[model samples]
Target: MVSITISAAKRTSLAKDLPATLNFPDKTVDTLTVSDVKSAFAAKYPQFYPSRQKISLKGDNKLLADEATLASVGLTDGAELAVKDLGAQISWTTVFVIEYIGPLVVHPLMYHFPSVFYRTTVEHSLLQKYVYAMVMLHFLKREYESLFVHRYSHGTMPFAYVFRNSFHYHVLGGVALAYAAYSPTYANTSSYIVGTIRDDPKFLMGGALVWLWAEVSNLKTHVTLRDLRPAGTKTRAIPYGYGFNKITCPNYFFEIVGWLVVCVMTGSYAAWFFLITGTYMMALWAMKKHRNYKKEFGKAYPKRNIMIPFIW
Candidate 1:
């Protein structure tokens, strides 16, 4: 009898075995079968080819050998064959959801819940819950750099340096806002009614406007503006062709104004603290980016001030 050889395709789970070709001597086996191959793998490596192993044979592009048919091939001992592991591949989509999508999308949406409670409650538990939610959102925000923004982008100074400075102010100010909104310490001690909230409609409207404007701007600047820079191209050199450069970082401008509105509406010292800190940090970062753009593009860059276009 002549030698029969078996081979498996490369770059698959089976490819780890070098030169997949196996030889069958003249008289040991009648014919190769899927069960015989699976049994060989099981006897050699039980954990990898457990009883659950599924093996099928195909010839002339047609399937062959149910369990019963496999048992009937009747090949002799030491008959050589190839086996492939058909276990499911790792789910990259699940990984993407956990690593990138969940924190950026899911967590923020859930964290905004404090304001909702503050809207409904005049009770102590409600006040405590609002503060607790704010604290949770604050801690959660530390992860934002890793998840929301790109890892690296060149500017005059390190992005982390600028971001961390701003982040510190942002969180502190936010904590103050939450404390002022829920805590009555300032309200009890304040000399002027203007310094403490007393359920004024104008302040509430301003706060709503600020918060709503920020949300809209966030969607536009981060999501909708859609800078189509090619892969590996430096984004700093790109002008704000979306036209927002008319007033640099209109999104950030709204963010500052929103916190101010919150401060007035809540009559909370904390809100003012946050507004001051967040705006200062953002102003620094925006100025750096603006300068970098002008330097990179020269006269081609639009004529615009750092924060306000015509006035400041």
Candidate 2:
């Protein structure tokens, strides 16, 4: 048997490793000694046991008594013992998303298309175009500053930020479409549609109204659902929870509707393209968040689908 000291917080974790076997002196039983553990670790992994620190012989998620306690319990020095490790594993979905979906597929396709399409002036008022440009700039800045650029404890990349950033485009596109309709820029235009070549003021108005309504709902609902610790103000917690939790990602849901409205108002194929893209991305994020909540809260999490009502 071995005498080992265990760390306070890690006791619960190391207890899980007790069932695994460890190295011991030759001619001894399958079990390890306290000295044998120290010696084996020092020789094999110099960095792990640089100095004598507390160690434990865990078995089946329980901490075994030290040598004295084991001796009292009638366990021999060579008796076999098991140990296990209780570290969380990486999810395969996270790997697939960061490696292929976020970087190679969704990001490049959805983000780059707008840059190419809006590269030139297409008869929309210069002022309106500039406003759209500002919105895009803000969207990019928020993603890079608040989400993408942050570091995390785990060895994972920033796909969540990318998904959130994409949602911004859906809403902003509708806003720009609608705002341009009444603005001095495109009011007197002879033709707005590309192929049909006609003035369509209703398209702009419809897109604008939807975008405005969606934004208001998103901001309000998000603020209502955020989680706050005692240190956090209720106001702060509500908004924060709305942004992070799966229970209330209303912003993403409304964003799709915003784009749909933009398409109906402006009659632009580009608008529909954005709607489809936003829907695909939001659905993935929502599902991932929902699974995480279920794992975290078990039966306590509020019953709700990603975006839709009970039907979804």
Candidate 3:
């Protein structure tokens, strides 16, 4: 037999006078599992329900999986196991809905419907209307994908940070787009769209194709990634097809393409700013994801560029 220690937070309902060590068979039993160990505790103490129980080797922050053996997680004769409550858990879908809907719903109102009673005297132009449509379309696509095309396993950011991210996307982005892209003067131009062709046929025809194709590619990449994993498991596979062959994060690549197309069409500082900053952040994230993929998959995964194709 072996003895193990169980620890919990003080002042809780856990029996304070319980002995520090509990006996267990020295030989590995075929039926003995981490879930069984936790179940024994829950049978004795109602507060330690198996679902609510989070056990880990002392000094390690990661929770041990239920299917894992006690010894596999480093439990031994004199080992200490820390038990704590996970408290409450929220689904990623719920969090994503709040994050995407704020910007998608609230930001468009400023561009589409403005009151004469408001303090800002912003007049609309054809370019302004076009920019408004594009911005609305971008955010609507994000909302749709978040709701349908993405599946998260088991990870969470703090609720406070989720609120902050929503504000950053909608409130900050809305003010910038409304102030710059919706200017009244951009539409009063007669510049040649192509090298010699006038009447803005270049952007109307060429840019529309590029922008929409990029958006669709981005959506396809997201759906491909979602199908790689089942509902609530932390398993992933190498992405195949569509955008995965050239770069590690083709979704970010296509998103950058969409923003650059907007800059070409509108020639607005806001569009350029979005393109540059978004590129910088996405590059950082792509590199991070690339490194993480390498670390996780090791020799089994293929080498790929971070965000760009061969140039990167």
Using lDDT, give the best candidate's number: 3
2 or 3: which has the higher lDDT?
3
- Better-scoring candidate (TM-score), 1 or 2: 1
Tens digit of per-residue lDDT, candidate 2, span 234-259? 22222234433434466677656655
Taking all chains together, each candidate's TM-score versus the true structure is: 0.45, 0.42, 0.75
Give the Cα RMSD of candidate 1.
17.3
User: Model 1, range 102-214, lDDT digits (tens) per residue?
Assistant: 32343333234434534532333332333334334433433442344322332123223443444443345433344445443323233433343333445445556555665
List runs of model 1 lying over 4 Å from the truth: 1-171, 185-198, 201-203, 224-233, 241-245
Give the CA lDDT, 0 to 100, for residue 273 in model 3.
Answer: 77
Candidates in descending TM-score order: 3, 1, 2
Q: Model 2 TM-score?
A: 0.42
Cα TM-score of candidate 1: 0.45
> How does each model score on lDDT?
0.45, 0.43, 0.69
Residue-level error in angstroms, candidate 3, position 129 = 2.6
